[model samples]
Target: MTEIALRAEGLYKVFGRQPQEAVERLRAGASRDEVRPATAAVIDASFEVRSGEIFVVMGLSGSGKSTLIRMLNGLLDATAGEVELCGERLTGASAAQVRGLRRRRVSMVFQHFALLPHRTVLDNVAYALEVRGVAKDERLEAARRTVDLVGLSGWEDKLPGELSGGMRQRVGLARALTADTDVLLMDEAFSALDPLIRREMQEQLVELQSALGKTIVFITHDLNEAMFLGDRIAVMRDGRIVQIGTPEDILTDPANDYVAQFVQDVDRARVLTASSVMEPARATVSASSGPRAALKVMRDLQTSAVYVVGRDRVLTGVVRDQDAIRLLRAGTTGLASITHDDFASVSVDTPLSELFVPAVESPLPLAVTDDRNRLLGVVPRVTLLAALGNVSSHTGELPTVEPPPTVPITVMSEALDAADAESGRAVPSGAQEGAV
Candidate 1:
């Protein structure tokens, strides 16, 4: 019983003089040529946008992304199928009903600024309120507040032509804000700006969306831009949806050759985060810690890396079972005698992109630490690989269990010995559980 803000089923749209006849032909399994128009704008599209979610549609030009958003807001009627907004059917809503729905429940921002050319920014924003019959003074007051919210506090009096393209888009956004709708549909709203301005606009949109918590459907052709802003992205091609998933899923585990090629060039480190890969810190010994201690700890644990803490319990280094055995052979006794101090460690707030460089550069698992330098957890490469695989499958389900604490060396050694015995195999002297 998850609440959905918007849902569409078997959504179909065709642009032509005989729209109904075209739909009838489609229902009868007629080819495109048998239909009235040569173009098939949308075909069998269906998806749901949850409340407070940013759902993005991305495709090349003429791929029906634009047409789809228009249908969502009742700007274009579906030639077939149905669209429901906030549990209300839209495909059959009357013209006046649709107008009221757009006015009170949905707002749209287009690639073009769409501001009135001759009106001041304030007036342009107030126009939406005016259409809803708010008092002149009240509409202006609301418009002023919205203008400030969009970071155009002092430019309320300036005309659209007087402002820069980015500023104009801000006015467009402010106008949408003034509508105060529960759903915001953006159709390439930032695509008209320069690259730098586009990035800034995208950031602003993210900030606004965070504060508003509205259900948003954003359309774009730039995959990176879509990834940056969308909670989920639906990729479209040839008037059909190819795949839908989070940016991490599309990048780490593509659905097929098409999606893989779509995200092949993305920096994997930049898009993946530590939370998805990090597990609870396991027990560790310093290089000075005894081999027997390390062995005991590894035997109790089923992990690959252990944090080596100093006397203060501050992270000093890390030790893997292989390294522990190597150190044991070299006559090392304590963890301090075997720990590797040079490795990548991440703070909790570190972005997924930033973790990649360190992860790739370090031979050991990535250690996670708090501000006080206490070990929080470790992220194994295998965990990251598995997370990527799950995301690629488009399931979008996160694992629920947290990794267990690190085991002491003695306990780990005993566990390993027991495991070998249970399996009827000889225990290797140096093969111990490593920390992760």
Candidate 2:
């Protein structure tokens, strides 16, 4: 079972003279407007971040996402409810206890790069260790290694003003990493960079997460960024969590109309994966089966090719109908001579956007495999298109191949936009199909 690294239970942060009274009024069948003077920043917000998961809190301006993050780190006190870090309560903990916890276990990365102007890059990175009273040489060595880790190897002696915006952000990241904290609270960490640089930082964060396995609570207002990075996302609206789900869940099946409208402009192809549309492989034969048997299986299934699998359903190769017939005519009994590994295969988690090139290039349907090389299913071109267009295929028949469309993803996005416009929703005037 996966261990939970952080947890928030029925947390509320109200700002007013009589804050606890506001909580009571709101809980006792009163609307937020009823508690006029007191503003509820977080209303019964509760969620858990499993170990090593990127749990994103996404909301628009004035949604109280920033306030909620501050409360998690104990920078702002929660008016009601509780927060637990690795099963230890934090709401009622003393200031020194929270300070010690932040120093030892949790770290934060701010949107604006907060670095000392006078200090060198090395000194800024080692500031946390300095506060912990580490020896000068020891902290500097640790800082040096962390600086190299963030791709700033030679600029250790440079000041913050000498680096670019992205580089200074890297310095801030290195500082957080140097503390060796297990949990990271990132509040709009990449929102300040330009589009390209912001995307690059998101990619770097994904790679670093894979390497370091830090539990991250990433705050962002950009829907694209949230879908691309989050293992699961919590959507906030007016200080209340409207929905919490995976990207595919939010895209394909939104919890409410608010969430539906918020995600209408998002490029579905970039977020949906092959697993979402893959059907069971219709024609498959065991490797030990002879050519006659393989040909019979193809004939029964009405497919031109049949996949060959070894023991435990491990994909060995594919045997086309023509090859099967040829081998049978040649009097060959075993299937090894006829089976060929000519088909394209992708992991089950591959995005639908990435499947386009291979789906168009491959002669057969793209094969889906698991980590153990087991053949899970196949994604035919027709099925890929139907999914992108949100067209349901409930006929329970094998998807037949069609002539590959030129720029299918773009066409699908335009189709979605037209549908949204007809429904009287504002369609964003741009199409980006490969953002994932």
Best by TM-score: 2
Residues 133-183, model 1: lDDT tens digits: 999999999999999988999998888988999999999998998988878
Model 2 TM-score relative to the real fold: 0.88
TM-score of each: 0.73, 0.88
Looking at model 2, which ten-residue stretch has the lowest summed lDDT?
403-412
Report the lDDT of model 1 for residue 421.
67
Model 1 stretches with alpha carbons more than 4 Å out? 17-37, 275-295, 298-350, 356-364, 367-377, 381-436
**For every candidate structure, what is the RMSD over all alpha carbons to the true structure, in angstroms?**
8.3, 12.8
Q: For candidate 1, what's the RMSD?
A: 8.3
